[model samples]
Target: MRIFNEFTFEAAHHLPHIFPDGHINTRLHGHSFRVRVTLEGKPDGKTGLISDLGTVKAAFDSAHEKLDHRYLNEVDGLETPTLENISMWLWRHFARSLSGLAQVGVYRDTCGEGCEYAGEYEIERKAA
Candidate 1:
């Protein structure tokens, strides 16, 4: 079975070193970010659930608090804050606690752009 949870956050960021001086990403801007965290596992016979929504949502609380209505560039490990980077950052955060984590999806809804990180790869790599 697979389960997922999502949350949104508002933040501003500038890709200074990541982009050229004349590029638009070098200019500070804000975005409404939508994130989805997916997990996969076999349902437990007693619980009949792979995992509960509460646990998934609880996993998002700390991440949401850190990113919401803030400057992403100021956040540790998020200085660049591109879609790909943001997804990886989230994967790292949630992977610490959620063993079933499968993937992390980060989207800039306004721009219709997004990225998904393979959480399982990181999990397996770490175990190895």
Candidate 2:
């Protein structure tokens, strides 16, 4: 079985690079961010517990507090705020801080469109 929890934060950022002329990102922009974390593992045979929710929550809380309503590009290693890149970066952040994390999803808007990653992730564009 799997257990899941979620966190929300707001942040601002822009790409300083990658443009028609290879210019940095555009001017800084901000958005409300949502992060969903899921954990999957078998319950302990003796304890009947996969993992404690408090443990995961604590880690997520710390991460969110640091990121909420801040300039994401100002944070080292996060110079871009694109949904796909942010999703992958978030997954790595949580995986390092929390144990048993199976996957992560990042929502950048109200619509269902967003990015998701598990373990190592890569974003690809498909032909429509």
Candidate 3:
């Protein structure tokens, strides 16, 4: 069985790497970012549910608190802040607690454009 939850956060970001080319992404912009967290696992016999919605929501809430109303480029793991990077950052952030986590989807807005990270590949992080 699989379960999913959605959360929204507002933040600003600019792609530094895209600046030299004068891409629009180089200018600071904000989005009502939407995140979908998907978890896959067999249902528990007692509860007959894959996971508790409240528990999953609370975990996402804690993670979203750090991103909401902030500048994405300033966040610890999101200095570059592309859709792909943001999704991967979220996957790492919630995977430990949500062991069954299968994927993370990040929507730039209500638009269909976004990115999904399935945790199928390793992302090297810069040393702090």
Candidate 4:
């Protein structure tokens, strides 16, 4: 079984090389970023839930603390903060705290663009 939840945060960023428009590429912009984290696991023998919502909320809360109100480019690993890179970063962070994660989607409303990464916490299949 699988369960999922979404969380939102705000961050500012700009693409350094996308264009020299001065306003779009140079000026800082913010977005009401959205993240969807999906988890999969067998229900606990007694609880009958894959994982409690509170447990999952911890991961989301932690992520918000790190990303919210900070400049994306200023973050440790986000030199550019493109949608694809942001999605990958979210996957890396949240995947460790959950048993199974199906996907992570990140949206940058400023540019009207977003990216999604699937199979983030899925078990790797070995070659036969």
Q: Count the backbone clashes (under 3 Å) in each candidate.
A: 0, 6, 0, 0
Summarize candidate 2's per-residue lDDT along 1-128 as a digit string, tens digits: 98888889988888666565545457666777888889899999998978887887887887787689889877665656677777777777787877788888888776556777787756564444
Query: Model 4 TM-score?
Result: 0.79
Tell me the spans in candidate 3 whose CA falls farther than 4 Å from its real position.
19-21, 125-128
> Which candidate wins on TM-score?
3
Error of 1 at 116 (Å): 0.3
- Candidate 3 residue 119 Cα shift, in angstroms, is 0.5
Pick by TM-score: 2 or 3, better one: 3
Cα shift from native, residue 95, model 4 (Å) = 1.6
lDDT by residue for model 4 (1-128), tens: 87888888988888976667775767788788988787877889997988777777898888888899999998986777877778887888887887777778887666677787874333343454
**Top-scoring candidate (lDDT):** 3
RMSD of 2: 5.4
The TM-score of predicted model 3 comes to 0.90
TM-score of each: 0.89, 0.78, 0.90, 0.79
Superposed model 4: Cα runs more than 4 Å off:
20-23, 108-112, 119-128
- State which candidate, 3 or 4, has the greater lDDT: 3
In angstroms, the error of model 1 at 24 is 1.3
